[model samples]
Target: MITDTIEKLVAKATQLVHLFNYCELCEQPIYQQVALCDHCVSLIPRFQLDSLSGDLLNRPEIYGLYSKCVFDHLIAISPYQYPMSDWLKQFKYLGRWQYQRLCCRVLNFHLNELLKLSDFCPPDIVMPVPIHINRWQHRGFNQTLPLARTVAKVFKVHCNADCLVRQNQTGSQAQASGQLRRKQLKNNFALLPNETSYETSNEVTGKRVKLEGMHVALVDDVVTTGATVSEISRLLKAANVAKVSVYCLALSL
Candidate 1:
């Protein structure tokens, strides 16, 4: 009990430090409850959670960054090809936060098609697949995190960035088969031990993580073959998260 209290204090202190260090890029007060500014906040495309079903879901695409372009309950948006294509270079790599908002808005816009079916549901919490510690240390940020956090905030649900964490370093997935890629990423995450217990908190994925069933919405910046999300989803299922629905800003075409 004492240790948990101390950890919470430390986490709060760190968050405060980050908050103070964060300057309003536009001098607009930076009042985002998540990490976005008002400009980014206003740009998110409105989406209906119930519109993802179609012929595409039934037939599922077979290749090119998307083996299954559409899920019976999943809809995705990718403005351009990935691995830092021009569009992604501008929005994801160049800190063009507005484009992040636009991408998410588009994802939301297409949600109606998937949700029309009953088997799918929006994730209870939005969790970005965490970066390897080494890369996160080098890059200074996980490019996908801000957008994922923003998506969670929009739905007024909890975002569990810490619940599932990445521990191993890895090579990029640019030139691998889908099955080989998933094997490469297998066993990459485990439930984190430091935060508040899922049981006591008023968080999303409301089911108990270590003990009972949970349903989660896994978020990512872009998914290429989905090896990363599938690996983590497997880990979460081992930890007993009942359902793992995925959401992404873009799907490489």
Candidate 2:
């Protein structure tokens, strides 16, 4: 009985350690698994929840920017700014693995809240916008993969990285104007042949999975000019995907 009591105490102590962490922003001891403490989390800028909907194009700010969009919907946690941008750069360029875990947890929590309050339809499949093989080799990872997997877990859908692919390596669009970005992004993406076979929830073993009529959540780390995702969305549309929803960590206005 005494040994059992000791083991139970040790387990509870370990559980507490896992549950609490120092807030990334404020360094306060936060009593949750999320990296940011409540105070710091509140300080992160967010779109007014009241204005969000199934189609973000309904918002004047977003609509004015994307007057016409190929993708059916958009969901994002914050505008591209401050700590979010810093976190992404650190994880993508510098490869701070902790930031990857931080980002996944933060985005997962934000998406959970959004789903609870909105009538948004969960997607049939989750797909991370693919990077060129060359870049993948250089970077050793696709920065969006972890975020995409998190979304797939939340929606309980297949995360297919093999279907859509970045065909050409283009120069950075960071400094380019929207018009230039769009021009450069044209034909930048292509889909794998539909004949490709895979294991999927809707199909039997050894059968091919068709994207036709499936709703896809295209996950990305950020949306700057929206060129990359828009181009990818067009490709998915050509594949007969019934819907394509853009989900990203941040949006640059």
Candidate number of the best TM-score? 2
- Taking the tens digit of each residue's C-alpha lDDT, what string does model 2 give over 56-168? 67688787787666887888788888878888999999989988877787787777766776666788889999998999999999999999999998887788888778878
Give the range of the ten consecutive residues with the poorest summed lDDT in model 2: 194-203
* Per-residue lDDT of candidate 1, residues 4-35 (tens digit): 99999999988876665221233444433223
Question: What TM-score do all the candidates reach, one by one?
Answer: 0.62, 0.86
- For candidate 2, the per-residue lDDT at 36 reads 74
**Clash count, predicted structure 1:** 16
